[model samples]
Target: MDDGQPLFRWSWVVSNWDNDSPNSIVNLLQAHIVMSAVPVIVGLLVSLPLGLLCVRWRWLYQPVSGLMNAVYALPSLALFMILLAVTGAEPVTVIIPLTFYAMAVLIPAVVDGLASVPEHVRQSAVAMGFTPLRRLVQVELPIAVPVVLAGMRVVAVSSISLVSVGALIGQGGLGNFFTDAYQRDFYTPAIAGIVLIVLLALVADGALVLLQRLLTPWMRARRSA
Candidate 1:
């Protein structure tokens, strides 16, 4: 369906940047970064305690995991539509739903990470008279960082991708390009948006991997062994 239209024109992408509107590519990119980051941060905070509770009880995990799965399964578009009434089409509406999505992944990661701590380690901490709270914060969570960050890597990428869907309600960040391109029968914005989104995901994932290694230099040594 060429329709005598050039599929991609570099000038169009440049023009999108040059455009002074709030919907300019630069503005959307900034919004995209902020919108994608806030949810993951909030979700991680929320998951830590919930994950701890599940680990402590064991019985609660199945039900709590099920509930989170249900929340994750809700279509983002539909959730955005529903949230629009309460948040009124703001970035929060997108962040709120993505937070649940992040938790759906992070909670399980947290549980599994905590569980991965060798029984001997916990016993040694107890033998050292480390209080439960102190052991958890100083000993357990540090060891759990790699696993939890693994989950966070996934959440970050997924959140970045999902934020594009917010364009449906006008808060989609770079996602606006997709909608705008379709409406205007143009291609440059859509292509640029995709490339940028992918690059952002890669950068974010790489940063998390670096953070993991930095936080657990011993693990890196073990891997070399």
Candidate 2:
């Protein structure tokens, strides 16, 4: 209640959070999750291959990597606007720019991770007649998993915040709550939506940390020791 009434009126929001149905916060959240997941998955898929290519071809590394770095420097809102013009205020518009953004961050991280693999390990694998495919899967990837996961964690958390901007285009999410609340002059709901986004980000970050610990037991053991 801002000045005397209930601040957020949980009951009201709970009842009216959906796009189709009356009380569909569930749908709102689902839309956000789907929107966020698409770009993350697509970006990772695209970046991993490019990262590998960067690792394989030393000459092209500087220029290709520089391009990704430049893309990373582009403002998210600007990218969104450019996409909006082409895709025209649809979910695709949001996802395309977000995918590019994710790639900008992920490709560099993946390349760095792959580079961090010990030179001795690569030499040993090559000497053993391991095919490049086998070497990558059996030797290089395992060592790079922790670093890649760390980069993904950063992207996942960042995407949650960035995805909220989709609400500006009528795409649903906690962003809808925020946009609607502000338009309707309802501070409580707006605050509730912002709080929910923050909480969601924290939860996602915590889950990634847990996953890192699970996946990199050797690192955990060393740290504990």
Candidate 3:
């Protein structure tokens, strides 16, 4: 409407696509990908151990869950604003809060996955003389993979969405395009960025699902049987 042609024309998107400069579409997209992925990865590493600890000591679960939920409930914008003072608008400001949110989702998933294993299976492992660590690493973790991967899918998609919110702080991935378009009243970049982001989320979720299938072939076998 603003440009006389449709706002989301493919011709405009093609014209704006630049690969060489840091501000190019490709670079912005890469930045977005890195920004989204790093927090989730860090969250997974931290939350898995913490979730296991919570399982080991049931008393810790309530407190930890409460804390993470509180953190997750905090507005992302507010958290970014608060962290800006400490981190000075660096990428860490965005990554740190995103990591916290990722953990909030992941910890519960890990806990539920572990808890889903039948008590008899755990008992059998104990009877078979499996050490606590060995049972956890070899038996319990493997069985919990499907549920944990489900959580990872949730976190990954949400994180990808949230990366755009980062653009408000000048740290957004593909989200920057929306902000740019709004300010300039140009639709091509925003539309293209959104399409790419949706594709990325779909691809990420599919990969996680595939990984889940790979890790739990018995589930597939049982389904076929």
Candidate 4:
């Protein structure tokens, strides 16, 4: 009941959990999950092919990578605004920028992972009569899975945090909570929203880590050696 302790009180948040309309904590959390996840998935799909292309065409790597890096460096909000002009205020505007940012982080990791495959391994695959495409698919990509997954973990965490920013334009996940709290001069929702976002990021990172371990048991064995 103390007015000054609005944000710190666990009781108020618990009490408000089932409140009507858009302010429901469950609704916001669900929205946040969807907004955070979709962009990363789209980015991974696009980056995988683009990364492969960069690796295959050595000459294209520099320019392509430079472009991605530049895109990554641009502010997320700024990028969102630019996309707004063309894509309008829809979710696609947020998603496109997020996807490009994910690509920027992923492409270098993918390119490096693919390049790191031992020359001897590649030669051996060629000797065994594997075509370039077959060798890439059957051997190189398998070896690169760990590094690529590491990049994915990074992308996933970043995407989760950034999803909140979309709330600036009413497209955010838990970001709306922060905006609402600030507008209403109440901090309980803001506090809850941030906690959830961090937990979501940690959960996502942990899942990716587990996936990497499952996919590359050899790496685990090598590490334990």
TM accuracy, model 2: 0.89
Q: Model 1 TM-score?
A: 0.96
TM-score of each: 0.96, 0.89, 0.95, 0.92
Residue 19 C-alpha lDDT in model 3: 54
| Model 3: per-residue Cα lDDT over 1-225, one tens digit each | 454768677776666677565657878888888888998899999999999999999999999999999999999999989998899866788889999999999999999999988999999999999999999999999988888888999999999999888888887878888898899888888889899999999999998888888889988987999
Tens-place lDDT per residue, model 2, 1-225, is: 246776767777656655576226767677777777788889999989988988889777789878877887887767777777778877787788778888888888888889888899899999999999999998898788788888888888888888888777776467777788778787766776688778878887898899888877888786889
Highest TM-score: give the candidate number.
1
Which of the two, 2 or 3, has more lDDT?
A: 3
Which residue pairs come into collision in candidate 2? Answer: 1-5, 1-6, 1-7, 18-24
Q: What's the number of clashes in each of the models?
A: 1, 4, 2, 1
Point out the higher-scoring one by TM-score: 3 or 4. Answer: 3
Between which residue pairs do clashes occur in model 1? 167-172
lDDT of 4: 0.85
lDDT of each: 0.94, 0.79, 0.88, 0.85
C-alpha lDDT of candidate 3 relative to the true structure: 0.88
Best candidate, lDDT:
1
